[model samples]
Target: MSEQSLFERIGGREAVEAVVGSFYEAVAGEMSLRVLYPEDLTPSREKLEYFFEQWLGGEPRYSERYGHPRLRRRHFPFVIAEHHAQLWLKHMRSALELQQIEREDFDSIWGRLESLANHMVNAHEEVPREPLPEDAWLT
Candidate 1:
């Protein structure tokens, strides 16, 4: 239900953070998505952790600290394409699967993640830029 908080459904901040950390770990090693993350994912992880905390219906820390998510605006500088989206989703799915979250809960979380990933795309060009090798692998 929309009224229910994400923290409650996902097992609170600790659980969400664990899932995110797992996802990032996979992302860091993934050649296609390694560059998507910054040199340090600590802040990024914290932000998402807080955002999801509010998004699932708990507190509104994300909006309170950052104002409108403006996700697209924030990701405009990145060269996200179909390949990148697919790869990112792969890692996320893997992480969720590893977490062994309930099927229904996994679906809900994956649906939102899919929408957000799709929304982050900024380029449709045939020849998209490549991520730096060092940056491409999160590891």
Candidate 2:
């Protein structure tokens, strides 16, 4: 039998959507990462779902709609430091945990995401700021 794609092994499109939702929930709960995402988050969630689906060997909807996934270029506007990458990975790890994915699959997916998140870092300068209120990101 042919080897199943990661998407298939992970339960396909619906699973991808669910993971994305869980991921965003984790992100929203993280003050450090929440501000990086848009206020509404719906569009970001959809885009992340498509991106993850394609990345996991499913249909390439993200590339089909958005062309090449120049992720670094796309994220240049954000102050994506190493701290941001680590926080992003933390939320993603939590999201994957909620799915009860296998160890090998989880490792594989997390490795790729860690690499991608590290590559997305564009800003090196320290983020000068004061302690933010709990709802500061909502603004």
Candidate 3:
């Protein structure tokens, strides 16, 4: 390839793998996010690594293995609220920093990811979470 892909710019598979690893490490402890993941993170880790590898321009392996990545559709089963997206991005930023991805390069990647995360927000806008008198807890 003439131009170096973002994958290459961030130091290819090894670096991407490390970043993804760091991401899950953070997620593993984050209860809000943790509840959303399976008890076994291995599959999630593998799938994400493959997807990122291809998305960042190393190989077509993710698509090859998983077919079309219907990301939103895949995520449809989850009740992804706004807070969840923010938490996801927060960990993503930490992961990128942990891997020491260059600011400029990471910025580009971060922007796209932010949009993607926001797009995954399936919940409605914030509303008062009050309960009706009958529904309120009996104190």
List, residue by residue over 44-125, the lDDT tens digit for candidate 2.
8887898888999999988877777767656665788899999888888877887867889988988888899998887874
In terms of TM-score, the best-performing candidate is: 3
Candidate structures ordered by TM-score, highest first: 3, 2, 1
Name the regions of candidate 2 deviating beyond 4 angstroms: 125-139
Ranking by lDDT: 3, 2, 1
TM-score of 2: 0.85
Write model 3 residue lDDT over 14-105, tens digit each, in one string. 99889889999999999999998879999889888988999888896677877777676566656789999999999988888877678899
Clashing pairs in 2: none
Best by lDDT: 3
What is the C-alpha local distance difference test score of each model? 0.73, 0.80, 0.82
Query: Which candidate model has the greater TM-score, 1 or 3?
Result: 3
Error of 2 at 131 (Å): 26
Candidate 1: C-alpha lDDT: 0.73
Model 3: how far is 85 from its true place, Å? 0.3
TM-score of 1: 0.79
Clashes of 1: 5
> Which residue ranges in model 3 land beyond 4 Å of their true spot?
125-139
TM, every model: 0.79, 0.85, 0.86
